[model samples]
Target: MIIRILFLFTYLLFSAQLFAQVIRYNTVDFSGMAPFWQVESSLIKDTEPDPDEWNALFDAPPYQILMAGGFSQKEFEQQLRLAFMPSMGSLLRKELDKNNPKSNFLRHVMQIMGNEKKLKELQANLQKAQLIKTALSMAKELLPDSFLYARALPPVSFIICDKAISHAPTGVIIDLLFSMDFEAYVPYFIAHEAYHFYRAKIKVPNLPGHNQPEYPIIQMLTQMETEGIADQIDKKKFFLNRGPFAGYEWARSYQHYLAKSPQAILQLDEYFIRMATVPNSDSKIIEDLLPMNGHPTGYYMANAIIEKMGKRTLIQQTANPFAFIRLYQRVALKDKKHYPPFSSITMQYLRKLEQKYYLPKKAEQPKQKSSPKLMWYEKDKVINNW
Candidate 1:
């Protein structure tokens, strides 16, 4: 028994050291959630709340990090206050506020409070150090083998909170209450959100300012590439494993959108053509047409690259969106029937933009007058579409 216990202790110590090298969970941020939830529950139940505990949550690392990272204080406070008085119509100040009792915010609060047993269960499960290690292990497995080689994955903290919306801006802020809905699939989300921080590390070349017409295209390109590659990290693995989420509604919907990725790509091609041919075209219409912030569409592109050129090529192109576009163009041409290739005009415009932006800033270039013999499309105005 003594030998077995020593072996187990040694094993756990080594495992923890290994996990720490890859990813670090912010235990300080996670530790605050349970206390906040308790105080929130007391307030919801009309019981006397601990003022000190309530105040402490606001000062906690999770709350402070979000506020420091530009998350609106009003919005953060509102999310917390909703649990205290969800039905008070006067409290709903924002036009975007979904005050319906069945709204996601209220619904999550209802779920969290209505099932004390489940909430406690989830809190215990989510706080486990093993869960982070396992989730990150799954994440590394899902990502392209050379994905991490392109750039260092940005440091990110995992924050647990009551807000239904989960996002990775500076840190990955997860909703403890809303996450209960995912149940066993929460690890999948953890992997997905963590990939975004990795995606953000890929630097964009110096490009047009926001006021320039090219700015919107740059935005669209970055959005698609970032979310597109990251989506595969989770969505592909989720389907492959299926686990308990095989018949889940959210899972079904996610797959449903993924199936429409082909159509989404064709739609984006049409938008790019307009931007290439027409002057001053922005990405708003394309944004409206794309599903789930260009995840499915971008996934289609990334998957196509992997299928035709191989994952290593796709991984190599991950750091450069311009290179990613060129690679996608190559793949689309190889299988024209399935993936519609971007037009020559669009390709030309993209190549020119890439060259102009990526040129060394220190090397001065002499601007020349447009040659009289140059074709209309070859001219600066047509190329820039400004």
Candidate 2:
């Protein structure tokens, strides 16, 4: 029995050594990436650590790399070097700034973990193996950009991890399951957050009476606006066959959600009606849960205005959310044929501007060519153009 135990221990130690020796890469192939984007992975293995400590030593690199040919440690590092330039200065800065507020925040969380005897218990609940696998799958599909462009400032970074937490570099880290599912919902979610980010950066003005002063109300309204616009874009693009996915369910759900607010309904009717008249009107499903007391109508209208303006204009005009509103009101008022009594007159000019500049051009189809002729030789005869 003693000899058997000793043999098993020896085997375990050897296996640990093999696992520890595995090299992981920290770079992404950007050559084939789209304009202003490159995909990156988050995990990499360390070399200096003892074999038994491999799991404890897995570091989240700034970026992850897809290796070439083999999964061996040497190939991993070779691919890493090919894809990224490691800056000692950046590393030094990150290390030295441990006392910064973000770092402090992380420190506080770490302390909490230490004090809460249940920290390990919670960690165990996370199922790290499952999280890592999910993250790997997401990395394969999303092809997330390793670097952000100067002009393209994403408001929220979708992170996949075991726990639900927020980090400075990572943005929001939900369970790896949510992050994996994010691929299905990301187009709309990204659009929504991007609007809010643009608005914050530009200091957009809030509505008069609707100017949010408290927490839930402000958060709710902001979410409504962001999500509403995202839904509109998704519907329009999808219906026209220009977007990643095809469907109108998400867009209708957004409209329905917005209509639930009475205050928004009173202010946004005309806008919604206009949106409902857009190319894919049948896709919108406004429930009869609320009467036409202007509240529900107003909510849809607001979304329509944002939708009509499109993302480029939204980004540019986001300096003042009020400006967009004012512009929308003006255009709504000027359309004598469709204008409501209180609609702002700037609508006409905005409409003209949209007609002149905002409409997206249709994608061109590739030209077709005639099929090529083939030649064949049989055992006894030669055939041409077969």
Candidate 3:
């Protein structure tokens, strides 16, 4: 028994050493955020992140992005309360100021619910900067002119985003930089965001200025263009880390579904286009999106764009979302043999946009403080499409 125990211990240590690449990460956010999650507690049993669990997570859809449907079993409903509003910096400051064990919202979730394990895992993993370095290296190799390589990877401040990883890298946010369960694939996530940052800095023609939001359909197409290009860039490197299996699985499954039948996704695309360009596309369609969980799944469009454009051309249109959607139609129209017949209406709409003419905006979106602020092309319509 003693010998067996020793062997297991040795193997575990050896495995960790073998996988621990020497890399560094900007801890400004990691450090800032760690203390809030690292507090001591007695009500929790520590559970470690399983590197093997991402596939299972992907098997259930919401976990792919929203981290929903009990996919994590750890970070779902209970976790959402932890981040309903943007509170990372404020949260840390509050914790420090109060210093009272009773005052921390995270403590209630951690100790009271036995989820301190997830928090601890996040704290422990951020110290391993090698993964960050790996993510950056992969991005640079593929797109040598990446924002990360050009200006160096930015400081990533980790925060809980309801219950999933997302890139909201505006001003100083890093959108929950690393999750323990998904740590190995941190680079893939980084590379995706790196492209968004890079693409944002790029000035392309006919897009709205920073001060003004682009039309909803145009915004939808832009998201597809940028995200599709980012996927093309970061996807090549994920096999090495085995981190983004769920994400890749999602993209593949979406593409497969579209190949077989595209009615549903195309419905979403048409809805968005009408919202943006057609004066008569009923704004009431906004209510229909509530069923979708978080606006239409732009990732579907992202997959379609990548599928239609091929890797080389998709990469080339990273900054030009307008061109990206146009190319998707161009490719789809060219491949009529493999694809289902296009709705003549869709075909006609494509022609209008291709001719650089789009329907005039109908009624503009109504503004209200009660409603959550929305990005271009959508209000807080769905729960999962992020």
Candidate 4:
């Protein structure tokens, strides 16, 4: 027992050092999430905190994601009401009230910070970051060069989310509240979200206007494509092991639906085809229409596209996502039998999309042409579409 304990301690000590070098721990963004939550929850009860701190926080990298993500105090509160455990919400606020003896805002912030949990996650993310960086560094010159390589390493922020996780154009946010082995699958989650961040930097044209028939379909496709790229990045490009993501294990729990076919997997999205195209259709209408009986339609289409294209092309597709759709269409031409029925639906609308957005008439194009980004995740509303 004594020898085992000693060995475990040494292993942990070495692991900690390895993490520090692979990816630097960034607390600035996460630390702000707490105070920002206080500001939102009335926990601190000081809506009138110093203007300077507010301005600085809004300006800060850690907090800049809020604005970049289009999340406001009102929307965040709504999410909190929906996402947070009710007991914890009430308890945390009461503990943080000014009259409480233990109401040090910073101290209370630590409660939800998940410091120890985050530290373990830090190790996982570091290993992932190292893998990604090493692969990119080794293959940077060998691979096709693009604007993605020109960008700096995106900062990672750990926080509590009602949802499992999300990434913004600015950074990746991993939630500690999902109640799982935050470390086991964190590498994949980080890589997945990081790819979202990376793709956001790419200057693709926005999907067709909301009223356009093509809008919702493309939005769904782009999400799946983004997920596909993230999935492939860690799995194929870097060749990293899943380690402990529990995805396969979770898949095992559903014995009722064994080995679902691609065609069936995509049929789920077809339920929303009309609803998504309708002007001002409620988002909830399509929410129930997730594919694979549970996975989003994006997951299925993205996998099909990625499997057909392979890694090298997929890497290039990050800079030009239109290529994914175009390439998928070409594959459909050659192998029409395997694609889902929705492939036909997309093929019908894609021509209009390419005409309206990608190949607009000269009169329709912008003057001082800044490339349009795929603004699906942070569309017209303050909410995150993903």
Highest lDDT among the candidates is held by which one?
1
Ranking by lDDT: 1, 4, 3, 2
Q: Looking at model 2, which ten-residue stretch has the lowest summed lDDT?
A: 1-10
Scored by lDDT, model 4 comes in at 0.45
Best by TM-score: 1
Q: Give the TM-scores of the predictions, in the order they appear.
A: 0.69, 0.32, 0.49, 0.49
Distance from true location, Cα of 313 in model 3, Å: 1.7
User: What TM-score does model 4 achieve against the real structure?
Assistant: 0.49
lDDT of 3 by residue, 1-386 (tens): 00001001111112221111221223334432432332211112233223343234233221222232123445432333333223444654465467453234344333323445655566566655664566566555435254444444544445542323433322122334224445655566665555555566665455444443234445555555554456555443442134344245444543444343445445655765674467576544543442222212334445555576655565565555445555665656777554333455655564555445333346788786596766866744554565
Off by over 4 Å in 4: 1-144, 159-166, 175-180, 205-207, 211-213, 234-243, 247-261, 264-296, 305-309, 315-323, 329-348, 360-386
lDDT of 2: 0.32
Q: Relative to the unseen true structure, what is the C-alpha lDDT of residue 68 in candidate 1, on a scale of 0 to 100?
A: 49
- Which pairs clash inside model 4? none
Per-residue lDDT of model 4, residues 1-386, tens digit only: 00001001111112223222433443213444444544434423323445554454354444344444454544444333322344456665665565442344223234443344564455455434553454344334223466446555455555543234554434455554332334444454454544554456666465567786555655655655565445443433222233333244333322123234354435533644544365355543433444433322334445566577665655665544356666666655666687644455545555555566655366665578776775776565545444
For candidate 1, write residues 158-277 as lDDT tens digits: 334434343434334555655566555566666666566555554566878988767767777777877777667666655423645445555565567777877766676677778778
Cα lDDT for residue 372, model 4?
77
RMSD (CA, Å), each prediction? 13.7, 22.5, 20.3, 17.5
